[model samples]
Structure formats: structure tokens, C-alpha cells
Target chain A: MVLLFTAGCRAKVSESPIGPSVQLHAPLGLPPVPIPPDNPPTEATIALGKRLFYDIRLSKDNTLACATCHDPEHDFSDPHPISLGVGGAKGIRNAPTLINVAYQSSQFWDGRATSLEIQAASPIADPLEMNQTHKVSVSKLAKDPVYRKMFTDAFGSKDVTLGRVERSLASFERTILSGDSAFDRFQYGGQPTALTPAQARGLALFINPIKGNCAACHTITPQYALFTDGKFHNIGIGVNDDGTLKDAGRYHETTVKSDTGAFKTPTLRNIANTAPYMHDGSLQTLEQVVSFYAGQGNSNPYIDREIKTIHLDGQERSDLVEFLKSLTGKLPPNLEEEKSHP
Target chain B: MTRFYSRLWLCLPFALVITGCKSSPPPPTAAPAKPAVSYFKVDPATAGSVSGKITFSGRPPARKVIDMSEDPACVAAHKGKAMEESIIVGNKSGLENVFVYIKSGLEGKNFETPTATVVINQGGCQFHPHIIGVQVDQPVEITNSDPVTHNIHPMAEINREWNHSQGPGDPPMHRKFVKQEIMIPVKCNIHSWMHAYIGVLNHPYFTVSKEDGSFTIANLPPGTYTLATWQEKLGTQEQQVTVAPGGQAVINFTYKGRS
Candidate 1:
């Protein structure tokens, strides 16, 4: 929860702590993150949001907050495949990385949520997660004049509605775009020194529709680096641990049969940084992920018919993993260690 | 073939029992060869679109920390963003998305296809006209833009079950409801946020609110009928509206807080 501004922050960022910070340009290959015109990213908002991100005080028992499950050191992902809620309650789905989420169209694997403004408030009251109610959280924040002042400044007026929280959180999150990486340099920058031969081969197979068809959802564009199409697909990973036939995928939301076992195709931009891929977080390692794809997904009734086991060996898996590794980007510069919490 | 005839014969009695209004879009499914119904002549007149907005009555709920249910993929990815909070626009509308439409009585209106077809396009990765009301048994085209496949799944009790995928640049999906239904939940089998409401009324006397909270149902027959507004969390309310022949009737529905 450290919000320390390292020495590099003042030197690199164009705006120190003013209206909206335009220090880090949106990576070449993506649309400029569309911040809501009403609530632009103010330094105070970012600082407050960051504090909230790391503040365990938001929970009922003061055990967890957003950061307890999502760690910046681990590419903003909880190292555990699935996250544990308050009182060590085990959740059904694995924790997803918050990296490059500003580009996403909808929230959640099933696409049940349409906006970050809507998705942000789901966890606090989820019995299995924070196990806290919004009334209590707001009551606690009401006690803190600093938080109240920040909320009013960030969102005008002092009601401190949940919508503002979602928007502010979304605004802070909008800054977490992932683009600058070796793969980016090699592909967009045309720097031959960036990508290794094995990585280049892996990239080719990824985009080559006949080979990897990775472009089917994990799209790479000249405007944006290789992330994803922000669409859901059935990659054939099942979470039987939850006693689900195929996790119901997007079908659970829409009640459509074709969506029976589909899930959102997550961005592969931070693939190197985000371990344990897939909606269920079943796959542990990148090697295992590529191998799963090579093997055409886990066998299940609702398995996507497109899940065809193809030919891939250990070496190819390693090569693909190497290419994915090339996508690691420089961390958000000048991260201050969160003020040591009591 | 004999079995199909028997089923068709069984359906005939039902149609006769409740013969549709004079201008039914498609014939009653009494018999495929000689349906016991009338097809509404396609009208060349322009139809007005109705839209409005919904606001809350009290302080909306704060962001709830959502848990990643059984799916680890969702858990790992949404550790921070999940169940954060829902957007509460305007004052205090508890729930945002509300499916509002003429519940009944419109099922027998004379419905004729119009030259100007409403698209209800899927643009910017969201379903346009989040709440859509169309004449029952009319082809509502679902189109896609992003270079990926998206499946359209409509959960309705009255409509024939249909689920299909439209690829990028694929042909528009022409789906029709054979019967009248209301507040039919429409969602993309692909994305959860891609939600929509299809008001499948047999008549054209229905409309939805825009983001600013205003709506108008055009060409409504000059008559006093019950007008209703319903939000998801805030329940429903009804008001009587009267219109003269070829004259417009102005009606305003204000939710007394969450109605």
C-alpha cells in the first residue's frame, strides 16, 4: 500500500500533482483510455484510490482491501490461482490481473457487467469476499474526514455515492495500461535487438490463424500491442472443483446454449507477468497454458468444438513461453512504497 | 408429415379462440400451407422512437467487494475491480437498468412492418438502446462490429428458442418472436455487460428512456390507456393517458422516489 513517489516521478511525469496527469502517454497500439469527462484523473483521486487499494481498514474485521488479493509486485495479480476471501473463504474463480483493463469493454469473465463503474462495487458485500456491507464501509469512510474531503473533491458534493467510488477506482485503474515491452519494441519499434528468434517464431505461430489462431481473441494490432479482443471464448478449462459442468461460461448470464462453457479471452499483454492464466486460473504456468492449447483444451462435454488438440512439443511450448516473456513491460515508474500501515 | 399436420391442427383451435387483431404481422400458425391469420401490410410511414432515463430516490449503495465465484480466471483477474460498486446516476435510483414496456393489451394491435427498420445495433461493444421495445413477431436484426464472433442469446418465454453467433462482417441475424412477450431479457452470450431488454409487444405503442430520463411513444392511437414505468430495483407504476384521433397525448411519469 506504499504510495511513495520515487525520485523518477518528478523528473519523468509532465504533471506533478495537478488536474489530470498526462505523464505516461498511452502506448502507441491502443486507444487513449477514455476517462469519464466528469471525473478526470486528479492527483488526489489517484493518491486516494491508491490508498484505498491498499487500505485493509475498508474490510469489516480490518483484514483485507483490494490490494490484499491484487499485488502490484505480481503484475497486479494475487499469486494464488484463486483468491481467498474474508476469514479464509475460498472463492470459485481465480483472481484476474488489473493490468490493461481500461481497454476492456465489459467486466467479469461471463461479461455480466457492462462497465467498471458497475463492477467495482460487487466484491465488498460478496459474502465470500470482503464479507462487508456498503453501509458499514461508507460509515467507516464517513468517520475519516480525509477520505470524505478527498471524495468530495474528486466527485463534487459530499454524498460519496458508490458510483463515485467505481468511477474513481476506474480512473485510477485507467492509468494501469500495459504496453512498453521487448515484444512491443521489436514489433512496433522495429528494433531487431528486442525479440529473440524463438520469440519471433512464437509470435508468428500466435498470429498465424492456421497455426495458433491466438488472434481469434488475443488480438495484436498496430495501434495496440497484443492484448485481447475483449471478447469471451471457451478455452476448455473446467472448474470441477466448484461442481460445475463447464463453469457455465457466458451462458450463465445470457442463458444461451452456444455460450454454455465460454469465458472472456483475457489480454495477453501482461502474460509474462500474470501467471496462472484462464478464467478459472486452472493453468499454473505459461508452459502448461501453451501445452493446454496444444492439447486442444481439457476434455469436457461443453468443450468448444474449436478445441482441437494440435501438434506441439516441449520445445515449442518453451519457445511460445519465451515469446510471451518478451511482453513484460517496465513497471509504472516511481511507485512509492505505501506509507507503512499500522 | 402426418405428425406435423396433427400438431398444426391442434394449434388451430387456440388461434381461433383468440383471433389476433385485424392487422397481425404474420398468420397464426394453425397450418403452414394455409395459416389461419392475416399478415400486416408493410406501412411506408415513419415511426418515432421513444427513450427516457431512470434516477434513484435515495443514497445508492456503495461499492460491494465482489467475490470471484467458482471461476479462478475471474477471481485472478478481477481481484481489485470485481464487485467494486455499481454506477448510480442522477439521484437515487437503486437499480439502474429497468425493463419498462406495455405489459399486455398491445398483443392484438394492428402491427405492420415499416419501411424504416430500427437497427438496435451492437456498437462500441455495447448493445445500443439498452432497453428495446419492438412489435411482436418482427425481425430484430442483431449486428456486430469488433473483429470477433459474438453470440446472441435472448431469454424469453414466448419467443421460439434461438441462439446463434454472428462473425465479424457476418450477415445480420434476423430473429422474430412468434408470440407476444415483455421484459424479455436480452444478453450477449459473449459479454456479460452486453445486456438488453426486448419489449416484445404486438403493438407499436411502446418506448424506453434515454440517459437523460425522457421518453415518447409515437403514433399511439388516440385513446386512454394505462401507461407504466418500471425499473429493475424500483418496481412499477401506472398512469392513464388519453389521446385524440391523429392528436398527440402528453403524459409524464415521475417515480415517487423508487416507485
Candidate 2:
């Protein structure tokens, strides 16, 4: 992806791109991103990971790829309620947006995997997903002379292992982080005119504890504007009619009774473009999601304590959703146009 | 003439109440008693038991090594090598992880739900105990010790089927199986190789075979009962036996391997 630097925000960013260890430019007010010591981000590894991310051969039936579900045109998220996998098989949860995913502490809707590298292998072998075994995928890549050279360029040797595959994919995903937007310009860039009067008012209500209270989970600090706490909570989606959990959310992972129906809190960055919100994609529009919060979410026993009644009238609700729309920013450059595919 | 005067005196009180004078109502009568229900109680002194051993006649297959290259946390935990436990055979060709329980008899009995927690630990991307038995309504605590995330999904036939993802340091999950379904398969959706079986029963007379393939069910009242054994790969076996007061009934099962 192309990293464009504008004249207005150069003071807020510190970017340094080296050979095998590229230090990504942190947007204004954000902390330095953590990188694993062993799998340092080299330009070659990032390039290789980009190819694997978009290649359809990663799946058993070469019909689907990571890009098939996380389309760049849709802000790296599936527009459908659930992602469609091999043989038209459907996933159980909605595809989360990859924007600002580098800042996330955990991965997946339930936060089952801890890192992007680890999460890369799950969909490939999942029977209802890519259905391609890691062993077989590595052997397929080994036969190709181009992939073999690329592997040697990224790692010290050309020997292909499943670990290398995950590392490369993670490196590519780390480059997909988002930051710059109207909200960032207004808050961090010291641009007074970036947001409208309605948006400014909406931002106020969003942080007000008794008002929108959205900042409780989707934090909006002046230092960085990620608009997410990166924690999990159950906002009462996918709950059974009798108050029992239908999906069981984080509870399925932790076995904690209180975590029932809890899912990772996704970033509000570029949320307007990524419609069909929530873990289940049950809410079609941002306005609907705002309304759901206004009504204090669905009545479930395990609903997050922060999801209390927000007494917002119709006009206030619309203003809050408008503020969420201002989170849209420039997306990563399209990888399909790159001429590096093998 | 005297009896006629007495009857006239009794009618005079009612006649007076109709003339604007208030009178009190009659008192209520006692309700009829309900029939008592007979509940089955163990006579401890006369309780019997059924003990058995599960044996395999054929050669055990070589265990498969798990490939955890995708997640380094799991690989590091296992020190780069981990084996599958689909069919664990101990000494003397005894098979482990078999669910043994009393299938029939002891009707009209009410067994108290066990309050003790049954723990199933997930470490190195595999269940610590591949097989577990819990009485209906008994708490089962599922825990994860690895630094990575693991999702636990129980595919129960006669009970609620549910799935959840658990990350490292998260609190242990507590659940109860409310049905008497045996061999409810449990799997980790994240790691395909991670699997376990849970046996839920109405009575507490059930035990999973240890590493030696031996199991004993005590506190069985003196009666005729059908003992059942279940294995994931091998189907199941049932045997009828009668136990005398404080006597032990020996029932052994043998499974022949595929030739």
C-alpha cells in the first residue's frame, strides 16, 4: 500500500522504512506498534505476504482467497452478514474489518487467536473455510520456482514451512493499519475546520458518560483516534429468545459465565463503509446500530454493564451516526494492481 | 309440646337477623390430606458394586504427531512434538478413556446432582483428559493454560450445543450438561486435532477407564442392572449382571481389532 504524506500532518508522524526491518510510520497520537523479534518486517516479506493474501491458490478449490471475503473495495471486510467459504459454505460470524487491526490485542470475533500470524492458518484448514491443509499448501508453493525465490528473499532460506506462511501474511496485514481521517485531523492535526458543527456536537455526546457513552468501549483520546478499546463485550447480539446464548460469544472460549455472547470490540475506523455491523452483521446500517445503542441494546442477561439506556432523541441519534461517518480515511493501496504476482 | 318450643326458639334467632340485626358467618372446615410419594433411598449397608476392565485384542496403531507450525505458542508449549490420543492403549492391551455406566435398572430412583466440579484442562492444544464423565446438572469447568486462544465446542445430541473462544489468562468456563446423553463429542474448532468426549448421566454410577483400562462403579443397590461401555473408535458393549447384598459383580469386556 502507498503511504502518502501530506504537507499538513508531517509534524505528527515519524516514519522510517529500512531494508528487512521497516519501522512503520505511526499516525499522530498513537503508540509505537509492537513487532515480534524473530519475524521482523522486511520489505521482501511484506511483498511476499501480499501475494499470498490475494492468491486464490491458498484454498483447496482455487475459487476463494482472503481477498474474496475481505475485498479492498469494501474496506477489507465482507459486505455480507457472514463470509462465504469454499463450496459456498458460510462462516458462523461476520468478517471483521482489517483496518487498524495491527493495534488490536487479539484476533477474530471471539478473540480466539492472539496474533495475525496465528490466525492466518485457521481459515485455510477449516473444513467450512478454505479447506486447504497447511502441509499441502506449502508443498504447492515449493513446486513453484517463483515462490521458492520469494521465500529465500524473505527468510534466510528457501525452505517453506507453515510458520513462514503465517509470518508473511501477518507482515502484510500489519501494513494495512489505518489512522488519518477527519477525526484525526480535527483532534490531532489541530485543524479546526475538519469537522462540521453537527459532527463536533456528536463527538461531545459520544464521550459524555451519561450521553452516548460510546467512548467507554470505542475510546477517542486526543493522542490517537483508533476509536476502539480492543476489548470484548456482549452487546446482546445472537442471544436466544429465552435469554440463553445462541452463539455464546467469548464464553465459548473462556468458559466464563459472564462472557456469554461477548465478542471483540471492532474499531470504528472506516465503519461507515463497512456496513452490516456487529459480530453477526444483524444491523444493516450505522443508523440502526446507533438506534440499538440508544435503546440500550437488546435485553439479555449477559449484556455489558456499559450498555445502559442512552436517552438520545432522533436528532441526537442522527448526529452521533454522522460523527461515526467522519471516521472514514484513505484505505491501503489496492494490491491487485501490483505486478508482482507469481 | 316441649320439643316444639325448642325448635321455635332456634328459628327465632334467624327471624331476628332478618329484622336488621347483623349475625356472624360459620367457621371453615379443615382440608383433606394428600397422598405421600415413595422415593428410592440407598440402604448403604446392602449396596453392591460392579467392577470391570476393558481390553483390546489387536495391535495398537502408531500415534500421529501433531503439526503446530501455525501457532508458535502451541509448538513451544509442546517443545515441537505432540502426539494424538484418538485411541490410547495402556499395559496388557487395556484401552483408556472408555465411558462405563449403569445403563438400566434402579427405576423410580432420585439421585442427587453432584456438586463437585469436573475439570477439563486444555494445554498444548490438546485436552488433558480425552474422556470425562459427569452426572446430569454437574458443573464442568473448562480451562485453557496455553498463551494462545482455543475455542471449545460441545456437539451434544440431547442437550444444547454451544461454542465459545477462550484466550489465555481468561477465567475458567463453567457449564453443566442437563441431559443423560453419553459420548457427547467435544472439539476445539480452532485446532482441528483437539477432541474430547463427555458422558452425561442421570445416576452417579459411572466412571471413565483410567490409564490401566479399569473402572469400578460403587453404591449400586442390590438389583439386576445392565452395564454399558462406550469408546469413540470402537462402538459400544452392554452386559447384564446381578449383584447380591454387599457383593461384587465382575464384568469384563474385550474388543477385537480389525484384522
Candidate 3:
């Protein structure tokens, strides 16, 4: 039997000598999780990434880590509408939940980064994020013996590079999946008694194309329910009060005429857990979000055709909100605090 | 004469022999023989192959980074972001995914259609084979491997246009193009970055360039044929060439690169 030490705790690795590959417990019917060829998860890489995830040294001031904004207690999201960065600088969009982020096609509200590796580097350099350049961070980490050993163990070299940092962070983020919700139990887990009658009714309304029509974009197949199509849409949220588009969402990247106000559609997986919703965090509660959709969103030229008029009564509105609430899945085990070094 | 008559009487059907007295048969002549029809066959002695490498002359265009933010599932399917395959220039500056085929040769000749189906997989919110070719009336099976739903809409000019959605667990969608549409562009409206082109021809002489920019169209009958190369970014180029029976012809297409 091989003894493995992780997060200052000793564990037994009875299965294999090469260390066990973290088998992600994906929700029933979810497609196999995609792992990048260059960054296939190993115990060493995951352990290194987990340490870096919670390491304050990643930031310039050492006061904030990734967990500062993406607090696991808050479902890997912040309660604030816009998250604060290194110097308490306000961000443009809400700190979206990292839960089940492995399933997203792109990163950020704008969908700028193609991979998690690309996305990982942006926040480290963003003035409003970790506020540390890759060069500075790499240099700072080179002096630490623990990080050097971890890097060498994770990668083949002791040298800390930006690419390695991105890969490790992405590896850690990939493991943060959320599933096994009450909805998952009822829908895919062979547990018919998991969801309440109200949730069952809500599920029906959410999928009915003529009524709720929510599933048109928030797709729900028989086996999996990601509750998001993973495409960007202009839902009239960022349109200014004077009828002009404000944020320009995906248009900033693609410059397409239709994408002028389009922003990526956020997943409704843990909608209840991550509050102050929408890209701009304009809506305060689930009721407001449902009401915004029911009212066919703020009337704008570029609004997605899927967002149409849906007149729901008070009870139906409550039922829909309850269904959204049912999307909260069990978060994975949290990483323990790293012990201080002498 | 006695032996022949006895054998005929014994070999003839009993009912026919009894009814033979009621009807007089016509004078015997050579049995009418069915004329044999000649099917089209490629004479190996007169067959040749066309091989070439697609190279870029100037700087290649930068691939567009596909924004999959619209669907998190798409982003999640890929490790990082996926890029557009429109102008894939390798280290050798060889362009990829160019559809090369015999454009004019064997126009009036009919060829047998392949019974096996061609597959186009939609994985990681992008088309697996960016460029493909199929004989007319041959089925192209499109499968969705990603966890998310993808709506495949092929906008064809000569053939009927089709738009269909396939989920992960659902069976693959099979489609056939009847007419000879040179290149039909397919786009997944659900995932804009997911696009592919299918080249349809009536004959079997067509090939798409691989990552290394090499392509081969084999088993061509000896003829002076107009071969056309079509790339998504760089427009079509046509060349006229003659091949000796059982000979090989080499042809190369160079596209001016765009920065």
C-alpha cells in the first residue's frame, strides 16, 4: 500500500502505484468530461493546482486568492453583483459560479478565451483581478522551495512558467464540477421521489416550447440537464436607458451586427446559490430573473428571438422560481487550508 | 430417328405431350439470345492518379478564435478555446482542408456510388472534418459527440437545404445530396463556430487535403481533365492536365497568403 499525503492529510492509495487519476463524479448522463491532451489530470498536477488555487502568493498583495471571490461556501461565487479585485477595483460582470465550469465552451462573460488555459492567464494579469503579471508571479514563485518542488513534480521541470501556471489552474478548475442535484436525482438518478410536485410542474413548464420555452436556449436533454446552450445571446440587459447598447457584450470580440448587445448565456445549474444574477448582476433575485424573461426582456432590436412573451400567473411564477432553485447540486469536497511553513 | 423420337417423347412433360396434338409449333430456329449490356468499368491499364500539395505563397491568415461563451458546454468540451479551420497553414506553409477534384473529365460517364456512408462528427462544438467530399446520392452521416445539442444546417444551392438538431444520445442524422453541388456549406446556428463544407460530385475522383497539405485522387481514366481546388478562404483554382494510361500526374496549387 502506498501512503499519499494531500492538503496536509495522509491518505491511502490502495489501487495503483502511479497514483489514482481523479475520477470526476459527473451527473448521470452527462457526456464524458473532456481533458486536454497536454494536461491529463494526475495526482501530482491536481495536488499542485489545488495548492495554487488557494495560494495567496498568486496575487500581488497576497491578501486574496481565487477563493476570495469564488468562495466555495458561496457555491464558488460571490454574493456581490460585481466582484472586487486586487485593490478593491470593481469588475464589470458578476463573479459567475465556477461550479461545473468544465462544461463551458468558452471562458468569461464575453467568451474571449477559447480554453481554460487561455482564460487562466487573463485574470492573473487583469488590473482588476489578481493584479499580478506572469513574469512577476513566476519570479516570485522561483524563490519558494515548496512551489519549485511541486512544479517539478507536476510538470517535468522545476522552472515555473506562465503556461504551467495556466495548465495547473485549469486542472484544478476542471475538477470543480457540481451535479447530483435533486433535479438530477429525479430526472436521471432513478429517484422519482427526489423532486417535489411543484418542481415537477416547473420542469414541465420550463421545457414546454409554447409555454415557458426556457429549454429553447437552456437545453435539457433526457440524460443531462446543463440548463444552458453555451452560446452567447443579446437579451436586452446591457441596453442603456436611452435605447442604445451599453456593454456591447460579444460584439467587442466578433463585431457582428446582431451580437452588438449579446453576452454569453450563464448556466442555471446553481442559479439559487449564485445570486445577483445576469452578466451585469442587474437582477436581485430569481423572481426578478423569471419576471424579466416572462416580460420578454427589455425591448431591444438585438434581443434573442427565444426570449418571447410568456404570461405566467403568480403561482406559475413561484413554481418556475422553485424549479430554478432545484438546480442547486452538491458541491464537491472543499480543499483544506494549507499549513504554514517555518 | 426412332431413338430421337423416343427420347423426345420420354423427356417432354406429360401434359405438354398430350396437348401437343392440339397446337402446331413453329419451325425451330436458333433460340433468341439476350444482348449483354456493358457497365462502366475503370480499365486499370488506362487508369492514373493525380497527386499534389497545397502550399501558401505569402503569410497565412490568422485563425479566428471561436467564442463558445454562448454555451458553456462547448467551452467545457474543449480544453481551451477552439479556432476556425478556414485557413490552416502548417509549418511548411501547406494549406489544409482544400477540396480537390476532377472538374471536367468524365462528365458524361456514370460511376457507381459507394454503398458505405460518409461520417461527419460534431465534437467539441466544431465539425470534425472541416472539408469532405461524397459521390452524388451517397449518404453522409452526421453525429453529435458533444454533450450539448447542435443544430446542423446545411445551406445547399443545387440540392435541397436541410436543418436538423441532434442531441448526444440521439441517433446520427443521415443525409444524401442527389445533385452535383461542388461545395455545400454547413453551419450549426446553435454554435456559430461550428461550420463545415461538403463537396458533392457524381464521380469518385475527389479528395480533401490533410493537415500536411497533401492530397491524392487515384483511379482516374486516361484523359485531359480540368482539376479544380477549392479552399474555404482562398477561392477555387483550375488546372488542365493530361495523364498517360497507367501513369501518375503531379499538380500543386499555391495560394497567396493573407496576413
Using all chains and alpha carbons, the TM-scores for the candidates as numbered come to: 0.52, 0.54, 0.53
Q: Is candidate 1 or candidate 3 better by TM-score?
A: 3
Off by over 4 Å in 1: A1-24, A157-159, A239-246, A334-337, A340-342, B1-259
Candidate 1 on B94-113: residue-level lDDT in tens? 23444445554344455543
Ranking by lDDT: 2, 3, 1
What does candidate 3's lDDT look like per residue over A1-342, in tens digits? 111122123122111112345665676536567877666777777777788778778888987788787787788888888888987988888888887778889988889998887887677778898899876777777779998788877766676667777777887888887678888888988998888989888888899887788888888888787788889898767554334676888989999989888887788888898887888877777876765665456545777888765556545656888898888876667554466677
True contacts kept of each: 0.00, 0.00, 0.00
What DockQ does each prediction reach against the true complex? 0.01, 0.01, 0.01
User: Candidate 2's residue-wise lDDT over A202-280, tens digit each?
Assistant: 8888999999999999987757766778788998676543347679878889999988889988999889988878888
Tens-place lDDT per residue, model 1, A1-342, is 111232223234222223545443577455677665455677766766676677676677889888777678778777777789999998878778887777788887788878776777677778888888876676677577777777766655444445556666666676777776888888777788789999998888877776666776788876666467777777656623222354787998989877777888787777777776677666667765775576455334566655553444445556778988988877676333366567
lDDT of 1 at A19: 53
Cα lDDT listed for each candidate = 0.61, 0.76, 0.75
Cα DockQ of the candidate 1 complex: 0.01
lDDT of 3: 0.75
Q: What is the Cα-based lDDT of residue A309 in candidate 3? A: 52
Better of 1 and 2 by TM-score: 2
- Candidate 1 lDDT at B195 equals 60
